[model samples]
Target: MDNIAGFIFLCGLVLVSATQPQDEILNNFQQVTKLSHLGLEFADFFQNVTLSDISLADSRAPNEEDLLCLRDLTLFSNALKERKLWALKMIDAWGSIPSGILTGNRHNLGNYDECLNINKDISQGVTIRGKYCFLQTSLSAMLGSDIGALGVVTRIKTATCFPASCSAAHMNLFVSQVLQKVLNLDIPSTAMGISDASCQTSASEPWDGLTIFTVVLLSLMGAIVAVFTVYDYFFCKNHNELPAIVKAFSARANSRALFRIVENTSNPNVISCLNGIRCMSLFWVVFSHEYTGRFFAANLNLFNVLPWSKLPFASFILHGFFSVDSFFFLGGLLLALIALRTMDRTKGKLNVPLMYLHRLIRIVPILAVAILVYTKLMTVVANGPLLQGFSGETACETGWYWTLLFVNNYTNVKCLGHTWYLSVDMQLFIISPVLLIALYKWGKKAAAGIFVLIVLLSGCLFATMMVNNYSMMFFQNSFSIDAMSNMYFATHTHATPWLIGFLFGYFLHLNKGKKFQLSWISVWSGWILCLAMIFTSIFALYPSTQSNTPPLTTLEESFYYTLTRVGWPLALCWVVFACMQGYGGMANSFLSSPLWQPLSRLSYSIYMWHLFIQEMNAKSSRTNSYFSDYQLMLQFWSDIGITLVVAYLLYLIIEAPIGGLDNFLRPQKKPAGVQKTSSYPIQIVSDQKVHGDGPSKLKETETIAQTISE
Candidate 1:
């Protein structure tokens, strides 16, 4: 016992002795970097500092004592001192103590306005010529607390005023040196260094090559629009001959097409409820994105926001990711319905290449325009402390081609991250023709095989979840990019919902114009079950958000994720099926209303533009915003209003004109004997055998292209 006690005491003594040098080095660093010492030095310098004195030609240099102090501070570790000597010298020569070092806190940002105000006040008696820089660092989370761990303050936004001679590169190098030398740790290069791009100085920045290119491209587009709009008014409207290109870009003609709403009362096969569903789903997405922006923004009361996530009513916001699945379902339904109908009319001679081309033309142009605007123009239009952090310019610049190719879900770059849905949707569309053709040739057997394939895909998703230990809840503390890329963003993992919609589409096609009489109890029961499934899918993970509740096991998470992915679509399937069959009652009347038509027409444009708008709003903030339900709703409505106006303009300038061109280029030929009864352009004639039975015929009618377009 005496030997054991002596040994323990000796080990403690050895540990304390070893820590003393590290403690001394840290203390020296703190003394050198402390706010009070730096403030006194800055005050003394300010008394003698003048515009000409601090000019690039004649900037003040570091004092000999300060340089010696830094050298002596690191002398205990010969290797560290030798390696960091240049960094220390550069920092001492060029760096100023950042204003955020004094005024910033974990809960609030440093006073950005005050920092600039101080610089302005200091230059009052002299020729105002100092540079104020916004230095951003990515290591704020290393502060070590629950708040830091949650990544609520993942970045440190600090300001520093330096002489015009202290270039942005010098300031960035200074910050990097201070962090590296003081932390005394080998931080990852990506995480510690402040890049030149991340530093914003008050100096007027010159236009870079990309910015100049963007300007030229936009000017050319504008010139084209102006020329075409003028040409369209005088020539196309007066019955004069014009080329297809002139007619395609006519704003006058496109606006008429955009505002015109045709109700297909005669076409009972049209799914009218889909318009409301689409518009509502898009609004939900915008609302969710607003919350996401707030969550990521510099919020003063981020801890308050976390508690709201636990509220029962907040499940709608928390689980709004499922809103994306709604689009997946709709995409599959429309593709299957249209493709199957076209195949039936053409006797399985569908033009697959043209179909793909048509889809690309419809989607890619607007997406490209959006990507260009986000990457090149956003920084030019907005400047603030947070702009560089969330602008995603770097990602978009490097990986935009992947996004354009509709394969960015697999890429690490998350340029316009929400666009992953488009990739998944496009990937699904590419493979859909195979299934459509198989269904046309083999009917129920193909569907049965496809169902089995969906199950297998779900199994793969479950296996992925188990291997990675991903949580079912998306907004959890442990949620990561890996979880999103593998499951939420992956085409295979999302195939079940989309394929389920395809099956529902097939079901709808088989029973089109057929009526089923059911007892009132049976109809009510179906509605109840459908509503229950949807509510369950949304609210089932609420418990996981609560502090008192234990985390879900891997088995539980996998099961919930797999089941909800399937169940959410199944519920939506019932709503569409019932509404089409006239059993939807009041629900049908509300969903099939004409009010949803205009908004639904703009749904695609709204989805493309809403996030961009939200990003601009969040990043343009000059100070930390307070998070609240009312504030979020206010922002959401404001975003929606701006989005509506932008979406309409986009439709007028791009989507509608492109759509008109698509129609003009691919004109549908009228059958020789058939008379035109409606103004709608495209028509399909369906007369095919069902299950190898006798031919089942329906009158030649207009295709629900507009309905599918929504």
Candidate 2:
């Protein structure tokens, strides 16, 4: 009897595997069942099933065996089965299981459009259309792969076509029943699931409340911009009788301000090198983000990133975080220069409240607009499997208020996580008046005290890292949330660079007009040292990125972190000092070029919009990008081009207008007398006069400093 049953089972399997003239559904059912060893009962169940037997509208509860066969046939069809094998094959050769399995196959996105466009006729009035669904599964968990030891969940893509009427909820139920009851295969809930967000019968999604709100808000803003633009062109040009609000919001006035660049022939005090630094730093930020965004999105050769990072030249990309430190240094430097100058002009009377208010005005409006666009409009912009996961709209929804308050870094909520720098900057700005006031009152004595304080703070930072075991290098395998929170994002940990810049600013102010004639050897030595410090800070961790290198000890990490934090800024300070003192030569010429002025002016807007553009590009992509230097360079240029155009519009529409409005609203003081001619030659360029005395004369200076600081 046993021999007879075995023979019958083999014959049944052969019969099912035989080529048949049938519809795609029947064909898929045969192909899927051929791989299963479900004995005579399962084979019998599928053999009897026909196109007419499978009704999407049939509400009656299916038999356990029948439902299992149907679900398997629908999900593991010929196309999807091929994709699964492709995914495994792509990653099989990779040495690092974490890198390979974590990202899965970038090319595993099965023909989504083809599936969605399927409109097959089952019978005369009964049509069975295809619904393309994205099913995410953990290959590591399913195959019991050792990648689970890395404590990361593996999300591999599997896509398939089902009947249009079979919704995600129904599919989920079918999968669960088949796994638990029919197959008796135990799987974790997190290991496999259907993505309802990715299931699609068509491209268009029904408009929701957030979409409507975003559209209306954008439309209203556009109407306002149009009205003000027309008013500025038709009426305000000829008449000065209109309200201040009209002039402030004028697109014409704002665009003019954005494009206008004045070279200060007389301002020996102006740090012209800052323009180049700001522009280049922003470019670095954008470039790094472009590469990282691809890593987060689907990259077919993601495992290659680890090997590429080991290269010496790769430090430029890997160490891009130093660019952010450069901004912090600039912020502190500009704050000291402007505040001290303002104090000198006002004779020791500095308006602390106004300083805070001005900082808020410079940051808040455009930031609010960015947050709104991210939270409300991103969903309306694109659709893809990656979009929902990577867009960060959900984080924005809950944490936007924290971002507005400039304290999101401490909290788990991060609307735009990159804006953590803004929070740190703001906090530093808030407390700076105490130091500024002291420096103004006591002069050199206060400077000595502040230097001592910086030293103590540096010691504390070193101690904190040592105690917490924070790694010096970011985004390495050993990097953790604890390290990021304690060292990377902490305000106190960053104070060393800011304070270093502050001292440099004060030194520059004190020696503004004094011509330092250094010997040729001294100048060359300074340049070499400056270049060495900067390069070391950027590339010191290259060995750590190499495959065979051991991880740095806690003491080594702390020492490197402390040294680099201070040394990097000190190197930058030398560049600025050299440029200002006329020893910069070709370096100064490049740094102080007029070409950098426009980009420097637009840097704030670029910083705000660059990440959004990068994210949008990454998330909206239907196909996985090939990871290579050539591809990255191409994407970088594309991202930067889009960023510049958007940043220009944002600057004209928001940043410039708000700045003008701020100037208009502030109570203007009449000129006291001819501005006291100090040894330092300061140039002021605006619609207002440069030589005008009192607070009014400081407007142009204030605006210039604000641009640098932002």
Candidate 3:
């Protein structure tokens, strides 16, 4: 009995695999047949109707063959109509036939028109004689065998029922004829199919795609890699390595932390704009990295033809996050203006220590918390390796120390590779002030000329890199090169575009008296051009395709590398100029919203922390089966959420407190221009009379400086 049961089970598997259901095929046939009939009927209906009849000139002529085809299609309609009726009638007598009988083969019943007629007559023999027709019988007889599927018919009489017509209907008739020749039209006669019956004795089985052992091994390997990656991201191997991070987040918050910058002003515009740009840019960075990383890992060639194959731009319309040079340029400009203003107002004697102290106060607390949280999650929670798999690449991984120290400018550290723009900006922080001091003394024209030269130099350098096909360096190098030679992009390479922003700011400040011409045409045109530049960058740049090497087409290569980096920046600069000129209307309403403020506030922390979160999520996905399909999207959003939470938390706990500590560490000192005044209210007189001086000559300068700083 057991042997018999096993044999039956094997037989059942074979029967199931050998055939597909008849209902699905029948439904498809009916659908296609109906559509063909509908097309034919519409043609006939329009034959007698003219455009003039409906007050519109009908340009297309109705095809006669279309009418004939519709008439012939009625045969299948009639057959289907009969089948439905027969099934209803046969319901009472069901199961009289063998239980295992197959029904799929009976589809051939529609093959002959005469056969159908005969069957109809047989079924209705002495009951009644009724005319069976659909559409028009006369029209049906005109098209011989061209109405429906030809293979469906078994005899000449059936074929004669529908013939092809030679008119506007030729297209439909041609399609109908081809379909008829392709379909199966036979009914099953056997109690069981030969293949299904054979399964009882000789069962069949499908080959397995993978063995159990192999699956287990793969799972194990995945777990190990995930574990290692989680460990690396969270734990600093040594205290000395991350002291600033520890101190900032520690219960006893300290003054010395990472990312310090000083400025002595409460200017809302400077602060708000910088913060907003940072947050928005970081979001863009995360999106680009997450999407692009997945795309490359999957080895998709969706945009193989396009050169600018990467994130944001290649993925969709809003993907221009990959084109994040806009933020860097903005920061550079703001920094330059602030620096220049300080110099001019202070009679060329800017307090460097005060500036550094202020910056340190703002930056360190947030930096510390970010490092701590990221380190904890990566090390303790995830157990991932530091730098993940980047341990092997000496050139690339060597920059991690520099990154932590925020000395990436000197060491070229790029722990968060995509975040190199931050490092570049930090380096700019040191250099821009000095440059601003020079601009105040040397004049705006000279400064602008120097900026132009730098831009040209950047362009030339990009040209050289592309010419040599430095694919590895282009993609891999994070932060060692001078701002001019940063390989990843044309904009953030060193401080090249930053310099442009600085110069623009300087010039804008120097020529402060000129009224901005907010002519509607120029404003709208500038806005339109900014939009066009963004779109062009997307279409022309962001997609990446697998190539043994980068393409060598000079025209294609030069165009993308230069235009996306160079042209887009200039276009953006123009946009900024326009906005400054008017600073109102739709553009202002959009940019100055309450929503933008928070994003700007958290932008820096988000930038610092997002990548570590993304790495964690990516590892988590491998372990969790639920995210198998939507891993990429999940990881992207997860990174964003984590970054926000972490940033806000750090902002409150570390950033806010660090400000106080920073102030304590470096107490506010006297301004360079301040001098000791006479202590007595009754000052000894000049020429034997009490003489009093008005407000210090430095009042206006101090006011302006204070305003600019704020």
Candidate 4:
């Protein structure tokens, strides 16, 4: 025991000593080296000086003799300690320091042979201040060179012992153009800060090797993912088999799991109001897409003011299409409610395969038809040849593959434009069933924790953006768009926002179970708060004060970019709360209208096909194609009109067929009585078909299975 204690003490002592101050080590070593240099003339001079006499300024006359003596003393002192030697070298390489400051003396003789002659002169012995001033200027220049050394120089007019004088920009260009070709890091030119001027004009030269590798790698990965996605979308689906878990929850003792919510029609006005909001949210999405390219432009005239054009409130109004956020929030809430109803009806298994299938059937048909027309028909009409424009930029078009495959965001770059949002929405929906299943199993606490984690992930993403010099990471079309596109796909950053929306929906659902007394005071206060958040989100999302940079004004940007990105979605839950509070009025009347029904029914289809129509219309000569490079943009509105008709037709044909097929497969039987509360124990069975991995062990699997059996 004593020996072990001794060993531990020795280890602790050694660890402490290792971390001791560097100055103590230097001081101890100097004693031995300084003793040997006592006899040397230069060393004698340095040794004679008391510790208090050390200073930057020269104490001697302005001749070369004094300068030589100073140099000799410096060399002798440097030789006494390794740390001193390094420090002296750093001073010299970084440009000189004041001798007076080091030695604690007040010599003012500034005319030294080695130092550059500036206008300042010190006839008296060199002062510490003068020496410090010279050191400051020299150090600044040295730092500039140090930074420069990191780059390459086309021409070397002079050379120095310190390499910082070399051009850093040139060195970076050489590394990118030459070294990277051999290394294959796939480092983007944007990441390296490479300029266009230094690179060669030829297409081959501009690409370097990294770009080509990136394109090939991404294409390969995308193809692999597509294979899995297509399989999951098609063959693995069993709308008829609706999971045992879902069946357990949806059914009463008499019925089954996975049931749909039948909105309370007790108050027609309230239902109407909620429906109206749904339609408005859909319109907001469409308008948001249309306005995105217009209002953000600094040069455009808006409301006759372009503060960027001296237009004040006009820009603000245009920016009000901030409604895209509302759409997102509304969509999440509705989906969550549906999931809740489904979970409650079914025992615990929601049919994920059927969910994906429903989405695929609804989105694909229109997209496929659109892709064919744009790629085949449009190409032949414009290029005067079929399949001629099927490669490169000419191949850019709205398509079914992205929506059908739940990869809308992934293919946004390939689509004409303004398609990323639609893609992101659909992608969110594709994964919703899986999320709902988790929510059903784990409950609210786990969902909230996941949401918080997602928000933190978004924070880290924002931090990355700040570190990378505010390079756009969202789907904005700009010089930084390429960088944005690359980083946006990082699941850690992008997918978190959707999770945030989901949690808000879940939270609202949890709250709805509790009843609160509705007083005049509370109702009015709720109204005020709802209006405030709406306006706050409006100002927050679209600050028209400035335009060259930052999506919002300084104040609004903080709230919009930092707060509202998450807050606005949560704020949207209050709309439902408000409608529920009061059953009748203007809000209810507006919502109950026939206008709301068609839009709500077609919202998903509209979101899917809107961009395709826009792109096609932009290609039309009648829309004044020459007036806008975005020929597909004017066509977007017209396409929306055409697509609505087409999508409605598809809903009747394509979507209805699959929905009907699922209904037929799982035909409703006679209503049964409620089962015992303990009968349906929640059991989660991993979809091996989806996970395509090993089995998960669970306690009481058989009992849980029997409980959920149809």
Give the top-scoring candidate (TM-score). Answer: 2
Model 4 lowest lDDT segment of ten: 687-696
Task: Give all TM-scores, in the order shown.
Answer: 0.76, 0.80, 0.49, 0.48
Better of 1 and 4 by lDDT: 1
lDDT measured at residue 355 in model 1 versus the true structure, 0 to 100: 68
True-structure RMSD for candidate 2: 10.0
lDDT of 2 by residue, 1-710 (tens): 12112222232322333454557536644444444222223323424445354543247766654454454455334323355432222222111111223223323455555565566443476444566666555545544555532323245454555556666766565455445544566666455556677676654667778668767766676677779889888877553455667766777766665566766453677667777776667677777877767764677766577677788877887677777667667767766876677667667676667667765776788888888777766756755545655556778988899889989868887888778877777788788888888988998999999899889988998999888777746546567777878777778888787888788778877776778899999999999999999989877887777768887888988888888888989999889888887899998888788777666666677777878888888766756677888998999899889989988877667666676677654655335673432222222212111100000001123353332222
Q: Write the per-residue lDDT of candidate 1 for residues 69-143, one digit (tens) a residue.
A: 233322312322354332222222222233222122222233333333322222234222234454443443333
Whose lDDT is higher: candidate 2's or candidate 3's?
2
Error of 2 at 392 (Å): 1.2
Write model 3 residue lDDT over 155-242, tens digit each, in one string: 1100111221212233223323322332321212121111111011011133234333334533453454344334434665644554
Better structure of 1 and 3 per lDDT: 1
In Å, residue 644's CA in model 2 sits off its true spot by 1.5
Best by lDDT: 2
* lDDT values, one for every candidate: 0.61, 0.64, 0.40, 0.39
Candidate 1, residue 148: Cα displacement in angstroms equals 8.4
